[model samples]
Target: MKPVDDDVLLTEVQFKELFRDQSAIERYMSGPHPLVLGHRVIRDNRFLVKISPDNLTAFKKEYPHDPIVDLLTTPYWFRVHVYYDIVTSEDFVVLTHGKPGISDLPVVRIHSESLFNRFPLRTVGNRTSSRSR
Candidate 1:
């Protein structure tokens, strides 16, 4: 991430406008829900989702793959993960499978929003936070 330009400043109105633009971009990029960081267990399998700077650093140490993690969200082992060119906006669960060295495990990346949007399901929304799932 690049440092903020200290020399640059914005008025309150400009800041608010920027904030709104950012929110729209995030929603369009990620989906309806906002991003959150944490770990969860789905269907008795362990998952670790790291998107925050601190957590990404920690995940990088073990997995050595920054900005990418996978989740096996189905009984048939369908893999899913957050997708972004530089950083992830979509919320996803990274299934650890009760093991270490997450990068060692084979996975296929899927943009959660795209998946849900492209194939709208009766129960599935555009995108869901891991906690909600």
Candidate 2:
């Protein structure tokens, strides 16, 4: 999702030991941008590290064909689905699509995910559904 953080790197053991919810921790670890570095133990999980504008050579070399700078700079967006979390009985996000939307203000669709077995809470509005997913 973003550039990896070099500072505050943690090992698998340290990560497992540090987090209480093993399942949630596992998701974080296995996700595309796992916070752990050496097997992904970085502290900053969300925001991407700023890529050096001048020295993109090495960065490009490290990830040939995968243009990090372009991907980061280009207009990229994701289509998110707003659904209710069955376990929590509250709203949750499920990423349905990725890439910029055709319309600037795309209409939000409220649908009950098949996995949720008939959950409620559906609404449609111009509001950004809290930018779900």
Candidate 3:
């Protein structure tokens, strides 16, 4: 493998074409946003969304939390899922609030994506997952 010295840059048009998704790009380009944890959303928006079966399996593998406890305690009504993206290292959750249209046209909360801030130096107990950062 050769170590290249020059920076590999792409034009705006090239960048946009390569990455088809625009919402994420627009979200960051638009403005600042808040950072919320999956546990907090589950705790706060308990009635809003329910854990999808597929997500439950994945979540159980990643995080050390009992969703059943949250359900038993708070009691969610609708079916939704908390998704974790390993590539971006972000949690993409949908809180429908038991509404019909929300699941289809979700209200997205956007935030600045920062790898440095995402993986902070903290105790293992406080960390979200055992996966390498």
Best by TM-score: 2
Clashing pairs in 2: 35-42, 36-40, 36-41, 36-42, 37-40, 37-41
Q: After superposition, how far is residue 68 of candidate 3 from its true place, in Å?
A: 32
Q: What is the lDDT of residue 58 in candidate 2?
A: 48
lDDT (C-alpha, whole model) for all candidates: 0.35, 0.41, 0.37
Residue 47 shift from truth in candidate 2, angstroms: 19
- Best-matching candidate per lDDT: 2
Q: Candidate 3 vs. truth: CA RMSD? A: 22.4
lDDT-superior candidate, 2 or 3: 2
For candidate 1, give the lDDT of residue 120: 47
Model 1, 1-133: lDDT tens digits are: 1212211122233334433545542532353332323323322322233234444344446765422322111122223344444254444555322232534433333334433345445675535644346
Question: Compared with the true structure, what per-residue lDDT tens digits does model 3 show for residues 5-122?
Answer: 2111222333345334656334323323211112112222222222234443444565536333132234324456667788966666555434434324333445444333366666
lDDT of each residue in 69-132, candidate 2, tens digit only: 2533444245666767556656667553233245423223356544432434454343333334
TM-score of 1: 0.16
Ten-residue stretch with the least lDDT total in model 3: 34-43
At residue 113, give the lDDT of candidate 3.
40
| Deviating ranges (above 4 Å) for candidate 3 | 1-80, 99-133
Clashes of 2: 6
Q: What ranking of all candidate models by TM-score puts the best one first?
A: 2, 3, 1
